[model samples]
Target chain A: MWMIDLRGIIPAATVVGCILLIWTLAVIPMNAHLAADMAARGDVVVTPHSPQDRKAMTGVTIAVKNPVIIAMTYSLDRPRLPSPHQVAVEMHNTIFTVAPTSRRSLVHHAWVTLSATLLGFVIGTTLGVLLAVGIVYNRTMDKSVMPWAITSQTIPILALAPMIIVMLGAIGIQGLLPKSIISAYLSFFPVVVGMVKGLRSPDAMQLDLLRTYNANAPQGFWKLRLPASMPYLFTSLKIGISAALVGAIVGELPTGARAGFGARMLVGDQYGQPMVTWAALFGAAITAALLVGLISFIERRTLNRMGMGAA
Target chain B: MTPATITARNLDLTFETNDGPVHALKDVSLDINKGDFVSFIGPSGCGKTTFLRCIAGLEQPTSGDISVNGMTPDAARMARAYGYVFQAAGLYPWRTIGGNIRLPLEIMGFSKAEMADRVAHVMDLVDLNGFEKKFPWQLSGGMQQRASIARALAFDADILLMDEPFGALDEIVRDHLNEQLLKLWARTEKTIGFVTHSIPEAVYLSTKIVVMSPRPGRITDIIESPLPRDRPLNIRDSAEFINIAHRVRDGLRSGHVDD
Candidate 1:
C-alpha cells in the first residue's frame, strides 16, 4: 500500500518538498537568531593591547563592525556546534585571504593530514596483513603476539603520546615519523583481525578440493585464500584509514609542533582564538572522509575486477 | 613401474569424535585392475566415501596399507595417479566452467596453449562446449558435476574416483549422465572407483560391486556383474540387468541385516 502510494511523480515530489520545508523551518530561524547575536560580540585582542588602551578599544570596535569577525568569534565561544554559515565563512576567509601558503589555511592543513594518512595507511595495512598471516599460520606466534597487541591498545594513546614524542626526539626521529607511528598503531589491529578471519573463510569442502589437487601451502594461499580475503581486507582498510587520521591528529598533540591541524588547535586554545581551532577541526574531518572515500572507491574497483562485487 | 594397479590390504579407519570412537571402515581389501570399473555400495557412513578418500590420499588407513599404482597413495598423488569427484560437485565458484576444467592441467604445468586445447577437448567430451565462459553458479547441478568430471579428465589421469557423483540428481538426469559416463569410460578406458547407495546404479555401472555394512564398517560381499561391457540405458530394463540389480539388492539387505 505504501509503495503504491509513492508511485506517482507528484507524490514523490511532494514528499521531498515536505522534507526540505521541515529542514528549513527547523534550521533557518535558529541560524538567523544566532547570526544576529554574533553581530553584537567583538573579536578578542590576542596581542594584549600593545601598552595602549585606546588602540585595544579601536580593535574591538572594528571587530564588532566586521560581520565575518563577529561570526568567527561567536563560533569560538560556542565550539560544541557551529552553524554551517559560520564555518563556511571562516573557511573562505582563512583559506583565501590570510596567508594562502600557511598551514593555518584549511587547504594547506588538509594536504598535511592527507599525506600522513595515506602513508600511514599503506604501512599499517602491510604490517597488519603480515601479522595476520603469522597469527593464522603459526600457533606459537598467535599465542604470543595476539595478547601483546590486545594489551597495547588498553594503554590509552593520550597518555602514550608524550612518551612517543620524547622517545622519537631522543632518537632524532622527528615530525612525521612519530605521527605516522601513532597512525600505524591505531590502524593495524582491525586489519589483522579482519584478514585472519577472511583468510580462513573457505568452506571445508573447498579445502578438500584443494587437497585433492595436491596443492601446497603457497599454492593454496595464492589460488584460494588470498582471493577470498580481498573483500574483508578492503573493509578493514577503510576502518584503518579513518583511525590513522585520528592517530595523525593525536600525534601532533604532544610534539608541540608548529605545523599540522592539531598544533593549530593548541595554538588557538592558548590564545582563545576559536575560529582558527574550528577551522582546523573541519579540515581534519574533511581529510578523513576523503581518505575513506578514496579507499572505498579502490575497494569497489578491485572487488569488481575480482568478481566479488556487490550483487 | 606400470604400477600393480591399486591394492588395498585390509584397510581399517576409525574416527575419535565427541561421541567416542566411531569405526568408519574395517578390514576391507580390494584390488582395482587396470581399466576396470568398481563400485562400492552401502548405507550411509558404511565407509564407501571413506574408502574413496583413502584411495585419494585424503585419509590414511588406521591399520592397513593402500598402494596406488605401486606407491603409497600420497606418493602416487604427487605422480597424479588419480582424479577425484566428490558427492556434490566441488567446482570453484569464482572460476569459469572452462577455468574449472583447466585447474588440474594448470597444476601439472600444462602450457597455456595446451591447457586451452585440453579444456576444449574435455568440454566437448562432457557436452559443455558453449558454457565454457560461464561460472559454475550459472549452471544446473548436473551440468556443474559434468564440468567437475571434465576437470578430473583434463589431466588424463588413469584412475577416476567418484563418490556418488550423480546421487543428487533426478532419475532422468542421472540416467542421461550415466549413459554419457559409460561412453566416456569406454572411450578413454580409465579405471574408475565409484561409490553409490543405489542398487540399480551399482548394477548398471560396475564390473564389480563391493557391498558394505555399517557400525564397524566392513565389506560383506563382492558381486561381479554378468552384463556385457557394451550396454545402454534400456539395458536396465533387461533380464540380465534385473538379475544383477536383484543380486546387489540382496547383497545390500543381507549386509544391513547381518549386523
Candidate 2:
C-alpha cells in the first residue's frame, strides 16, 4: 500500500527518461567514425576523402558532413559504443530466443552465477553471525577476531582473487567452491559488523530486567539478543548479498569461467563483442536488484509484524 | 509480626571513580515484612535504586549483609524469588503484550498451558485483557508500564521491586497507576520495595515510607502508616495521611541539610 506512490514513480520515470535520452544522443557521436568508415568502404562519397585524414576528424565533425551515415552509426555490426537499442536487442535475443539450458542463453549464465552467489551468501552469513556472537559474548574473540576480520578486507580483491584461484586450483579444488569462498570472504564482513552492533543494542535496563528472571546465557541470547538483531541482520544481508554477487563475478574472472555472467563479460570483451558484455553487465545488475529487492520485501513484512515498521 | 521477606544490615557501598570514592550508600539498614508495601522516598543519587538493586542481586554492596527470604541475595536470585520493574517498561518491541508477559514463564520452563494461563491471568489483572495481540509500540506509555508490571507479576514471585516505574508518566496517569498498583498489592499480598522521588506518591502507596537523602545515601526516618489498608485516591486529604506525608517531607528536608 505504501510503495505505489505516484509522486515517487513520476520523478523516477523522469530521471530514467533523461538518462536514456542522454545515452542515445551520445551514441551518435561515439559510433559516428565507425559508421562513416563503413559508408566510405561501401563506395559512398565521404567528406574527408582520405582514410588517414578521417582519423584526425572528430566523430561529430565527420557525421555532420555525412548526415545519412547517422542511421548507419546506430546499426553497426560491431560499433565502438553500441547504441542502446543494439544492447537491448542483444539482451532480448540471449534472454528469450535461446533455450534456457543452451550455451548461448543468458538465463543459463545468470543461474550459474546465482547458485554460487546464494551458496556463498548462506555460508558467509552463518560464519558472520557465529563470529559476531563470539565477539559480543567473549572478550578474547572481540579483541582478537575483529581486528583480523577488518584487516582482511583491506587487501584488494582483484589482486587477491587470482592468488586464491591459483592456490585452490593447485590442490585440485577448482570451479564453484573457489568462487563461493571468494563470495563468502567478501560478504562476511558486513554481517559480522552489523550483527555485533545489533546484539549489543539492548540497554542496561533491558539486560537487568532479564537478570531479574535469572535468565541463562542461551535464554538471554535467544529471547533478547537474537530478536534485537533482526533489523541489523537484514541491513547487512542486503549489503552482503550484493557483495557476494560481486565476489562470484570476480571469482569467475580469474579462472576463465566457462559459463556465468562473469564469463560472458570476460569472453565478450576479449572477443571484441561489446554488445555481449553490455547485456551481461545489465543482467548482473538486474540480478543484484532482484536479490536486494527480495530481502527488502521480507524485511518490511517482518518488521511490520514486530511493530518496528518505519514511519 | 509477619516474617521478614528481605533484610539489609549495616549496608555500605562506595564507588571508586576518577575523582574519588563516591559513596552511593552508607550505613543503610532496613527490613521488609511479607505483604508490606515499602516505599523508599528520596532525591536523585540517594541510592534508593542501588539499594533495590542490592535486594534483587543486580548490585553488590561494597560492605554489607543483605538477604532475601533468609537466603543470600545471589541464592535467592537463582531461585527467582523476585520480579524487578525498572523505570522504563523495557518491553521487547518484537513481542506482543501477552508475549512479553509470557517471556519469564518461558525462561522458567513453564508448560505451554501454564504459560498461556499465567499470561492471560496477569493480562487480565493489569486490565490489559484485549491488548494481548498488540505490540509494545502500539500501547500508550501508561499501558506499556502496566504491561511491564503484568510481566513481573506473571511469574508470581514472592517480592516485586519497582524503581520508579511511573516516574515518566504525567501526574494524572501516575495517579491512576498508583491506585491500580495499590489494589494489585492488596490482592497479591506480596512484599514490594518501591523507589520513588515523590513525597505524595510515597505517602499514598507505601504502608511504610523510608525517607532518604543523597551524597552518602542513608535513611533519615522510617514512617509506619497508621491509616487503614484500603485507600481511596481522596485518602491523601485525610488528616492521618497528610500528617504522614508532612513527616516524610520533614525527614527529607533534614537529610538534605547534610549537604
Candidate 3:
C-alpha cells in the first residue's frame, strides 16, 4: 500500500527530457535554413560547392516539409522569433561582457532592485504585524488605522509615483529611502489583514483552554495567538515581497535615476529598444520568484518543525 | 491531612447580552474535599459549565465567592494548583502530543529536565508513551482526549476540573477512558470536579453526584455513590451501579429545583 513520492527529481528529469527533445527538433532545420539564406544574400560564400552540400540542403528542406511552411505563413511570415540558441547566447553575453554596474545588463538592475525590495518587504511586514496586533487588541486603533490603510490603495501607484517622488524631494529624502518607503506602503495592508484573521482564527474552545490555564494577555498572545498566525504571516509575506518589488519599480518610474530595473526600462523606452526593456522585466520577475521561493522554503521548514507539516 | 480543595458559596453568574441580561447560574453552592471524585450531572443549559468556569477562574461569579484551598480560584491558579479539561479535546493542532503536554509547564517556567520527566510520566500514565510526536489531528478522537487529559496531568496539579470530558465519545471509548481515569485518580489522588449529561457516567465515575436542572439552573439532588472505591470496567454492569444509575435518573426526572 506504499506510494512512491516523485515530487523532486522525477518530474524535473521529465521536463528536462521534453525540453531537449523540442530543442533538437526545432533548431536543426532552422540552422540549415538560416545558413542557406545567408549564402543567398552573399553573407557567406562556400567555395567549391559539391553534391554533398546539395543533398544536405534537400534533406533539411524536406524534413521541415509543407506543414512547417504553412504554420510560418499563418504567423505572418516575419523574421523568425529568436530561438533558444539565440536566447542562450544573449543571456551569456548579458551576464559576462555587459558591465555588472551598467544599465545595459539586466543583472545590474536586478541586484539594484532586489536589495531595496527585500529591505522594504521586511519593514512593511514588521509594520503590518504591529498594526494588526494593535487593531486586533484595541477598538480605537481598528477604527482609526484600518480605514486609512484601505484608502491608501485607492490612488493608483502610477498616479501616486510622481507625487511620492516630489514629496520625498521636498523633505530632502531622495534615492533608495523614498523607493523603499513606497514599497513598504504598498506591502503592509495585505499582511495586516491576513495576520489579523489568522491570529483571531482560534476556536472558542481553544481560547477557553488558554483562559483556564490562567494565561495572562502576554502569555496567551505568545503561546497561542502568534503561533496561530504563522501560516498567515508567511503567505501574506510572499505576496508582500512581490508587491514591494512592484513598488520599487514604480518608485523608479518618475525619477531621473541612473540605476534599477525600472530605470533600465525607462532608458529602453527613450531609446526605442524593446528587447532591453523585456530583458530587464524578465530579470525583475526572476528576482521576485527567487526571493518568494526562498521565504516559502523557510516557512515550510519552520512549520514542519512545529509539527504542522503538510499532509 | 489534605485540604478542603474547592468551596463555592451561593455563587451566581449573569451574562450581559445586547438583548438583555441572561442569568446563567442562580445561588449555586458546593464544596469539594481534597482527592475526591465529584461529578456534576445536569440537563442542557443547566449552568454546569458556568460553575466549572467559575471554579477555573475563567469566569467570575456575579454575586458570590469561590475559593480553592482557602484562596480565590484565580490566586490558586497563579500558584499552579489546578488543571482543566474542556469538553473538546483542546489540544493545539500545531503541536505534538509531547509539546502540548509541556505547554502549561513551559509557561509556568519549569526546568527542562523536570518538564521532560513530567511529560514522560504523564504520557505513560495515559498509555500514550509512544505517541509523543504525533499531532492531535493524526490521532483518533479518543486518543486526542486522552492526550489532553495527559496534558492536564503533566503539571501535577492538586485539582482537575473536567467539563464533559467523555461526553463526545462512543460508549466503548467512554468506558475505556472512565476506567483509565479511575486508575489515574487512584494513583495520583488528584481531586476531580467533572461535569456531564450522562446519568450512567455520573454514577460510574463519581463519589458525589450533583444533579442540576435548567431555567435559572439550580441543584436538584446530591447523591453519594454506593459502589466500592476501586472500580473497573466490569463494575458498570453490576447491580449496585445500576441502582445508582436509576437513582440519578430519578433525580433528573423528578423536576425538582431548589432555587
Give chain A TM for each model in order: 0.75, 0.96, 0.74
Model 1 Cα lDDT, one tens digit per residue, A168-204 = 8899998777888888888898899899899988887
- Please write out the lDDT profile of model 2 over residues A1-311, one tens digit for every residue: 76689988999999989988998988888988888888989999998888789889888888888898999988898888888899999999999999999999999999999999999999999999999999999999999999999999999999998899999999999878899999999999999999999999999998998888889999999999999999999999999999999999999997899999999999999999999999999999999999999999999999988878853
Tell me candidate 2's interface RMSD. Answer: 0.7
TM-score for every candidate vs. truth? 0.84, 0.97, 0.83
Pairs of colliding residues, candidate 3: none
Off by over 4 Å in 3: A1-93, A96-99, B1-3, B256-259
Off by over 4 Å in 2: A64-66
lDDT of 3 by residue, A1-311 (tens): 13767787799899978986785566445544434443435544432144355446653463344233323321221223334444455556676888887656668878778777878888899999999999988999989998998998898988888888899899899878888888998899899999899889888888877766667889888889999888888899899999999999988888877788898778767875444565666678788889899988889888887777763
Of candidate 2 chain B, the 10-residue stretch with the lowest lDDT total is B250-259
Docking class of 3: medium
- Locate the minimum summed-lDDT window of 10 residues in model 3 chain A: A70-79
In model 3, chain B matches the true chain B with a TM-score of: 0.95
C-alpha lDDT (0 to 100) for residue B33 of candidate 1: 87
Candidate 1 per-residue lDDT, tens place, B102-157, comes to: 87776677999999999999899999989998877779999999999998898888
Model 1, residue A95: what's the lDDT? 82
